[model samples]
Target: MHTGLHFISGLPRSGSALLAALLRQNPDVHAGITSPIGSLISMLLREMSQGNESAIFIDDTQRKAILRGVFDGYYGAISQTQTVFDTNRLWCAKLNVVAALFPNAKVVCCVRHLPWVLDSIERLTQQNRWELSKIFNFDPGGTVYSRVEGLVSSSGLVGFAYNALKQAMHSEESDRLLLVSYETLTREPQRALDAIYDFTGLPPFQHDFESVTLDANEFDARLGTPGLHKVGNAVRPNERQSILPPDLWRRFEVDSFWSEPAWNLRGVRIV
Candidate 1:
């Protein structure tokens, strides 16, 4: 009774959680809320790095249990006909590292405009107990947020993330994947959900579209002033404005080393 694995990945705040939450409403789908295996795997990597001698082994039953645990924790309890979904930001990267482990895994990569993505990240840093370095695993004293801000403002981070995404898309197992954009999903949610349903082989659910709209004030609160300041004007920019500040956008355009045809190849226009 092994349901196939489905992954929803994207840049931070690109609606991965929203998508997962929406998909969970479907009776035939069970999304993992907490993935113990992923957590364990992360801990195992940390242990190994610290020279700990703990051996992590996976057998068939254990694998099934881990998958089931992931399903129940994130999406809810699994049913007989349910397709399990694991929605996490870094899951795609982990999926790439262990592609062979799950033969029938399906990956969905979510994308958002670079400017908006950077803006969202910046906003989060300014509000609450924002710690960019801790989240990104950088030194506590390092200027990680500032550096990231520079990269995003200059559009360099977009290309880097896009390239990484492209590499994931081009894997030999690429057919079992789908690439989606946040703008499309936000604007035409029904259409986007329909596409996601088709891709994941799940039936559609009764979704609350109105409840999902992005809240400007709330978003700003989470992001803070400095983060909001950098990409504030770029939110849902018009075509002309999409050409962000020239110097920064040009970096990714000209860098051959960072470019990947499969990943960077533009699909449908999002905005």
Candidate 2:
């Protein structure tokens, strides 16, 4: 069955996985950890572009239809009553494509402080000391400085998403975007969820903050970074000292553009 489609995207180590777990509490909502649908869409676009010799054979109408079918076919098995919220970090960069395909769909971006985001990833890396992380291409060895540098490189995981999110905030379709802060979500989940419900035009449902749970153990295991997506059985802030050195922390502090109101030129909603 087919129904409205929304998206969950934002920085890594943010509350996206937690948000998906909570959103799933509402029977009408269907969401999960990041899916390959975004990558699939990207691949399809590249294949249809001039990079492929067969591109000349496909018209814009056909291209649009094919892209739309990706969503339909991906969630085609879900019940018609459910509103699908696909999770992917690439959606922020593809807002124009999404706007054309599903004008009403809103993108909920979960964000966190840049330093803490890096700290979270570092924590996971340290915990899995026995295994090399797929994040760094399993490169065997490097100091925290090198790792932090790699992460903030333009094409790196955090860097690309950060840039894409900034792009979305200033986009003409900014009204269709919502930023969910990790602090706000952990300290005031109900408030964040209320804003999300209003933005997506979905009826509110009570979520058990004390019983939230999501197990992506296998997924993280495959990535060689266990607990990467594990948010525990409860939705609460886990306060701790930043493992990041003060120098490194300060270096990336300025990268958190979402913290500044002036950067939000299009008035993208933040919760």
Candidate 3:
């Protein structure tokens, strides 16, 4: 019995893996660490575009059907009654294709403060001081200004996802989107889980918050990050000081754009 598909997306280092880990506790849901389906979405879109597969007799309707099959075929391995959630930072950018292919699908964006997100990355870099991370392409030459510019620039990682999220929040499918904040997700997990269960319409499972843990070393290593997705074995308040210089951190803390009054007007719910 096939159920439906939703997405776990938004900024990296913002609890996407933690959400997937907790959701997996529900036997009825098939959620996991970031999946490659988003990349596949882009790949298929290019393959099916006008100058490509369209010239080979494949039409738009057939293309849409085939694209839908990709989800079915990929997650078809999960058992009956299980909901599918493919995690990726790229899904926020692919929401249009998602709304078209799986009209009922929702994208649950994992969000955190931009300054803290950058601080988290910096902490990891310092902890692994002996080695350079692929996150910065192993280049450690830049000053704080340049490094930040790389992240907030239009083509940068966070910039791109933030733009994509803003687009989805204003879209006609805004009702299908949910923003899950990291602070609430880790602090008051029961409330967070309840909200997630209601949003995705999945049967609730008794999650063991005290013993929650996920190991992503093998996968993280592939991306040149060892503990990028690591979380405490328990869901509890995580308090830590920023290792970044005060001035550097202040530059990115200027705004909490996602929670501003303007988005409320668009009817996108933030919890």
Candidate 4:
């Protein structure tokens, strides 16, 4: 069987982890959190392997180090499984790079409402030690800066990331890609899981769907509040309660260039 790679990407606080956790329930799938740095390294390595002079050169150990560096202390240690699922929120725009490396890789882009995404990001910034500004490289003035600045200033980077992913889905290879909304997943997890299983060709596992909800509170608590040790350090609650006031939400506009009507299409509901 060919080993498959599934990229579970989305805006921060958009339930990438939740989706990963649900997919991890399948015995045939090894889904875990990864980072953009890993995607970059993989792309570079792939390019070099293809005899592309524009790519950088590094020894085997050095190459492994680069990959490992992106995942904190767990570099190059990813188990060789039949199917590896990388659930990284930062892999939103970077998917293009990853696609170049693994042309056959399957992508699952998760999305959430723009207003809620911004609200969640704002809350996370105030409550957690993590800095969204630094992560997204936001700036008030600068060409590249404006791209993400608009998101941070209004709906937050989550919206920007969602838009980027949508654009990526338009590629000729998009049929191999799956776009999953966070709301749909939450409302009907089993149905979502079933779709995922079909997409990845994984045999069903005899696990309770409710088991995926094990850390519901701990996960919710991290949004805007302090992190709980039990649920792992990664999860956080929304700090701002709401990202947009009623007036702001009304005034906030979705750029025509960034809208994806395909996302509005109703698909299978996994309720």
Best by TM-score: 2
* Candidate 4 ranges beyond 4 A from true positions: 36-39, 42-79, 89-100, 128-150, 153-156, 206-209, 213-243, 253-271
Residue-wise lDDT of candidate 4 within 1-271, one digit each (tens)?
2346667765655566677666666666666544345556657567656377644555656655555454433324343444777766545555665555456676777766666665555444455444234434433233323433556543454555655565565554555566666666666666666776777666765445455532444443433233321223222232445645565555444532224455534331211
After superposition, candidate 1 runs with Cα above 4 Å error: 32-37, 45-81, 96-99, 127-145, 149-163, 213-271
lDDT of each: 0.52, 0.91, 0.80, 0.54
Q: Which window of 10 residues has the lowest lDDT sum in candidate 4?
A: 227-236
Stretches > 4 Å off in candidate 3: 51-56
Which of the two, 1 or 3, has more TM-score? 3
lDDT comparing candidate 2 with the true structure? 0.91
Candidate 3 residues 210-239, lDDT tens each? 887778888878767678888788998779
Which consecutive 10 residues in model 2 have the weakest lDDT in total?
72-81
Q: How would you encode candidate 2's per-residue C-alpha lDDT over 224-254 as one tens digit per residue?
A: 8888888878888889999999999988888
Query: What is the overall TM-score of model 3 with all chains considered together?
Result: 0.93
Could you tell which candidate, 1 or 3, scores higher by lDDT? Answer: 3
lDDT, residue 195, candidate 1: 83
